[model samples]
Target: MADETRATALRVGASEIRADAQAKAEGREAYAADCYPQGLLWAGAVRPGARHGLAHARIRSIDTRMATAMPGVVKVLTARDVPGTNRQGIVHKDMPVLADQKLRYAGDPVALVIAESPEALRAALCRVEVELEPLPAVCDPVAALATNAPRLHEERADNLLGAAEIRRGDGAEALASCDVVVAGEYSTPVQAHGFIETENGVACYAPDGTLTLTLSTQAPFRDRLEIAHALGLPFERIRVIAPCLGGGFGGKDGATVQCLLALAALNSGGRPVKMHWDREENLLAGYRRHACRIEYRLGARHDGTLQALHCRLVYDTGAYAHLGAEVMALGMEHAGGALSHPQCSDRRSVRLHQ
Candidate 1:
């Protein structure tokens, strides 16, 4: 039996070892961040500084003269430079590639600076000056739902991104009649993916206008569509090559560096353009797990059998709607908890501006 088990373990298809594990352990596995093509340019985003304080604001103007005049600085592009709809998302076609009229969040990129070197790119970005008109901001998800609250998106009449309710039986009536009832409120903070790789990608535009990108992204196929839609390029002309990622706990499952790298490549005069987000930028601009507040009311019989459950889930989905609706729907689906109950009432809402 022992000999047979060893033989099975040695079989090609039945091997217990991961094929890439050895390479990765020996530092021989090449990730997207390791790629450095010849004649590569560096691109960086200029976001609202800490001095701005407020996340919500109007962009009065972006003065790129200083950065444009700096040595090795290639070009400073803003939202106007983006060709297509300038929007990218999975299901919701929101989130601007660059902030145009409004700076939706403190980390919102207002300008893209391209340079011959990473040092030049950072220096140039620092030289770019922006004038903003501060807008009334909402920090609380519940407060953002108030009618008197300032609107984050003019299109969205309210800060509510999505809402839904699930009902199985007469939960309200059942709760009142139960022999024992308990209530509680639970809250969770916004969580970062904290992937070791961070967000980085390299893109090069061919003479024929074909754009190719090699990135550490979890969604390479979807990235092609996102790049095409955001930059007005033909979907067929875009190619995304996803390499072995160092880490990506759902953080790279969305846009991340896809659209930005493509846009930088387009303006790099056909040279390969590389954009890498450092740890700080990753925390500020990365897609994060939603912060949630949940209220629960549980009713049980004298025998300790659960009779009814009522739950209200509210999630702060941040400035942009990145799978906000789907996130809320998932929470609603699981509001009943692990134990089964005959009656359950679940209400969920996804809010923005957090």
Candidate 2:
């Protein structure tokens, strides 16, 4: 093959043509949010309205009677409708797909409303009243570990989810011996993936007792396992198809609408169901990157050679334990020698303050 006549060499300095760029630029791209099939019912989640006031609270009651009676509303579902564990998470299945007994955060889903029309879905969502009993929110990570702070999980003694760390080569002693030592703590806020596509998916319940899910997701295969586990359905019965994402940005890696949409499809009586999160809903219900506080003490030779590194990290997982501990482990391991991240560490309080 001649070098100049080759296909790869035909376009060196010329403008390149892309398959999707033109359509996307001309606003002709078909996104998951734009997926509207015939006779599909609309599903919208009813979130805790109480979070506007408190960082944490207990659900006294979720009043869905008004929503049930609304025109064009098909069904109203709660956690009780979910089967099996009713929990969703890749690494830790601690977060409930729907808040059954209590509302952890203000954005926790308390109700799922299916409607014949989008307008009906909106109206039903507004009518689903949620009464919350306020609790002392563990807003402070350090204070959350206090002897008397409210426990987020009944099984957990304190508010600490868990921790991951690594240590090697007497780094603490090495830091002291180093000619130059720098000790500082840096904190990072909870960052959103902020993808243009806000967790949207379409699901259909087949008459043959199978569920088909089509959506914009980064993890379709994992979503099948999550859906089946949470809904108590046979894993083989759920079919997942991931269309090209409008935007995922890692936010779609976890369960956002997968379980909820499947549940809606189950109750819809073989009808096609669509659940598209609006900007406001996405902002409230979407996944957030861990808000981490990192305390690092770096010691190095005066001649600028890397020597010792000591770091402590605390991450706020918000209401649910997402990939919090794993994220910490990744950062910690990147800086030190191999050490297993701690799981179920027995209580022995360490306080730096007198």
Candidate 3:
């Protein structure tokens, strides 16, 4: 009987094959990174030579002479070459497209080297020597919030980005009336979105002053706005085309290679420029889920009915505020579990433990 059922299911499935299955099997699907044109320029970012510091890297000497003199070498452009605003970000314009002042993180881009061949681009990036004056780094969030800690952002007092609180039904008063109370602490680890294809894209500037981008992005519509605002280009001048992503899972929800690739394309002189992050580069530089520390307290009646509930959630946003506060807010909202008792005086009280 089981074999008959399986056979019937197979027969039904055969007529309803997925549309993407045939194209994938035949290798006909076109991914964004696969859209390479003739005479394409290769672009790569020069990562920090060291770790954990205020990266005061000066372009005192970029010995690109060897790279330029080499076969199939184009131009090695630094922050000085960026025609518009060299900064890029989603909500907060804190990140620089090319690091001009000091390298904030180890993965900050110091130079954008364009070459006729991928091999030449790699060689040129290696030859670029960036002299950096390292400053003390605040690796820990708690230490970063300390009064005397080195400020990551000079405009802010400490490293505290944001804080929020929610209250309902006099939780403290109701907790006193409860017969039983429970308290505990919990912590969650940082999660990585291991997208299969990694982050990759291709960008090209047309002769008509239009910048076109084909990228692995989830928010292609929103990416246009961010690119225009960051690069100081007209919104109509930028066009973004999103293809079937290898995987996004929220990590690619914001600006990744869109802005940098756009900048590289603009400097490519109408030639298409490609940027593909290998496995290691993606893991090291890609954004991850925010790590969180939570404290929970619950008050209950004698019948195991929930009375008052309170929780404090703290999240390590890490460098930028990439939906960290929203994630914490969602976690706080679910702190009461699934059940709610009317006999209980207090229903919910959740606060962001900044």
Candidate 4:
């Protein structure tokens, strides 16, 4: 019935042309991902290689001599170049803008290469050498919580990032009095956004020491804060302009090319710098929907009236804590629609527990 109402309402005035349809269809729309300032120096990353593998490892040494000597390669930057916090995240500032001490994921960037052209940037990135030391890694969540499992962050004692609960009425007591009950275990696999435009951005550091950035991002204002905080620059000095995007779909909701590209521009001697991830890079580094495991028990009266609901949900945010806690909270809001299930008392919702 609710679905019918929603569909009916949409049909009345739906099918209206989109605001960006004409510009997009005419190929006249300018996307932040496609922004290119004049005299743009391309920037690329040199990722840690095979010694320690992608699952986990520790950084031993980074050798950028060869890449730095490349004809067009301007500067080879590492953790040494990053100032201020050197960490970036929407909520938790745990993810390193440049991987310094640990390589949490296979996609962790070890170094940034700035060059005069895309060809030079790619060549320089390939020439950069890195050495890694293998460490005991806990790839599985169940194993990660083990007493002896390797700690991803030495500061953190366990792999359990967080937990949550929702509640209403005497949930357990209500379930005990129910006439019908069903319980099940459910799981969902991770799904990628596969956005068409990929991740890309352009940034410029002006002679006046202020910075301006135009990029394909969902939150431009937030990007300004992230860049300012991560790079140790004044927040007011940075201007983030999001022209438009071919597509973002939450993948661009957080920092993607903002901080790193800004770092490149900082050292580009007033020249604009650009960073655009290719298809392969995006798939490995881009954000995706969290895979989840849920245990739910539903109780109801013999008359088909829902009496109570109890559910536990787990969200695997992967290498970084992107919107893990927030996403889980949203799913718990409905508890698979049990909140709308009719109740015997005036109370119409199930409760949540930690």
Candidate 5:
């Protein structure tokens, strides 16, 4: 028995076996996506521009009458149905839980539906029609920076979400003194998280008014405050439970279904509410890594000694500021190469556009 116990004990520099490996390999381990509580209602959001290609538009009206009349649908909620501020974000509270006025992106939620069944949820969501007045949309980062470009957020003056500059020493002067200089322009496209599990969660509002959520998320603790602020619930009354995630890759670092699920629970008549973003919906609404354009200029002496580095980075943060400034800051920090440089200057801009 002692020998068997020793075999399972952890040791330094030893290959520690994962306890859940066997269950996962056998498809027996239950993930958050696998959670379906009894008496749970299905919740889904209606994105006005998802199928119509209207990236930028003014929401004229949201028709939820037909959806509300559905047989199994419990409730159809719009921005007015939201309790509190209805806004949520990490650094900037610019994103609305449900778009009340304007549709900045095709993925912005216009209406939320709660149903007794998945079929009812789908049928009800389809019935929730939205009339939008299309507006000009800027896709490219450079074009978005133009003075005349359309602004996604009216509160902001320009399409630039955030900007920062890092200077170590005399960057341009040192580059001019170098014997060799190389310049290049590089661009990367928007990439999705594509997590196998997608974004899924379940929430319940207890009789004591505690909102408990079980989700497959990377930032469970942060989700608590996001839900609280969006739904007007007290932070102490909210509970977030993070189960084993199939994959996150930084995409689940923000609220996905946290606010929506809580909203559903609030109107679910004390029953639990579940929300699962399908493959298409996940691709449509999931947070993406910023697509960026980099203008890099490197200076080196004739003997190959690195002298100075200067780079300008412009990031496309889509229609919302979801950690856009922080992401740009990280890009600027890594602009310098592995070696130390006497002079380095990095400028970064986060653009808000489709």
Candidate 6:
């Protein structure tokens, strides 16, 4: 009788689970992309073609005549259309909202086009002709540090962005006093955030001249200030609302869709403009973790008492200085553990490899 009861219970449980699963099996779940508005305009960016190079491409001639004449085409704007500062950055104002003079990376934006229909937007994007002058590029950070390397920013010396160091005792002297020592090299690779949603947002300009933005962002509050400053609009004039992000992983901490979408909304004629980054665009244009290389040396007494330590850390900050200095500083702080000896030697040094 007990065996019979157990079998019946198992059969009932399976049926219940099947019933719950059937709804999803028939495609009952709804995602955000499934929703459509009565009137929607699609907005997108025209990224630089090269992976790394000097961006001397000037929009020498925009044949927007054909695009504007196309059915459902709204407006085509360039960097010159930007009325404000035209730059965006978290701690430093370096990145351009729209490349007016030069493109820093291959994925940098050169133009923004808005159209009544997705088909129209696609046609307009293709019709837009850009003339670019290709300059020398620095692919490796170590190569960028060479004395003869091309400068990414004219104001900076070489490609080196910044450096940091920490020292305690006489690390060089302690190494001589120690009987045993170990030297090694280590490296870390770049990691992606891999958020499911990628990066996306919608922007609208109200009749009263207020810009409202709904985006999948991590720092919605800071984004508001950044957008306003870059667009040359009053901070109060912009209202940024963030929803549950698909995934961020610190990649979206700075400008992603905020400035571009805001510029789209400004030229959208009070109509809402939406920008959604596809998987390829997200991968190519997205910010990544700093790749690092470390050289370390440790010395100890014959009896195994730690004596001296020295290290040199090199961080590859990629094209832009996105949290590179801060990341290197953190590495320098953790290079060596706490020590208790009075005459012990410890030193840590960091170099930014562009």
TM-score of 2: 0.88
Going through the candidates in the order shown, the clash numbers are: 0, 0, 1, 8, 0, 0
C-alpha RMSD by candidate, in order: 2.6, 5.1, 5.0, 5.9, 2.2, 6.9
For candidate 6, give the lDDT.
Answer: 0.77
**CA RMSD (A), model 4:** 5.9
lDDT of 4 by residue, 121-151 (tens): 8888888888788776665555555677777
TM-score of each model, paired residue for residue: 0.95, 0.88, 0.85, 0.89, 0.95, 0.84
Error of 2 at 313 (Å): 1.3
Q: What is the lDDT of candidate 4?
A: 0.80
lDDT of 4 at 258: 89
Clashing pairs in 1: none
Per-residue lDDT tens digits for candidate 2, residues 156-271, read 66677675444446666777787898888787887887888888889998889989999889888999999989889999999998876877776888899999999999999888
Check candidate 6 and list the clashing pairs. none
lDDT of 5 by residue, 120-176 (tens): 998998999899999998778899988999888887788877777778788888889
Scanning candidate 3 in windows of ten residues, the lowest lDDT window is: 345-354
Preferred candidate (lDDT higher): 1 or 2? 1
Better of 3 and 5 by lDDT: 5
Clashing pairs in 4: 165-353, 165-354, 166-351, 166-352, 166-353, 167-351, 167-352, 168-351
Candidate lDDT scores, in order, read 0.87, 0.78, 0.73, 0.80, 0.88, 0.77
lDDT of 3 by residue, 197-241 (tens): 788899999998899899998899889987887788899988888
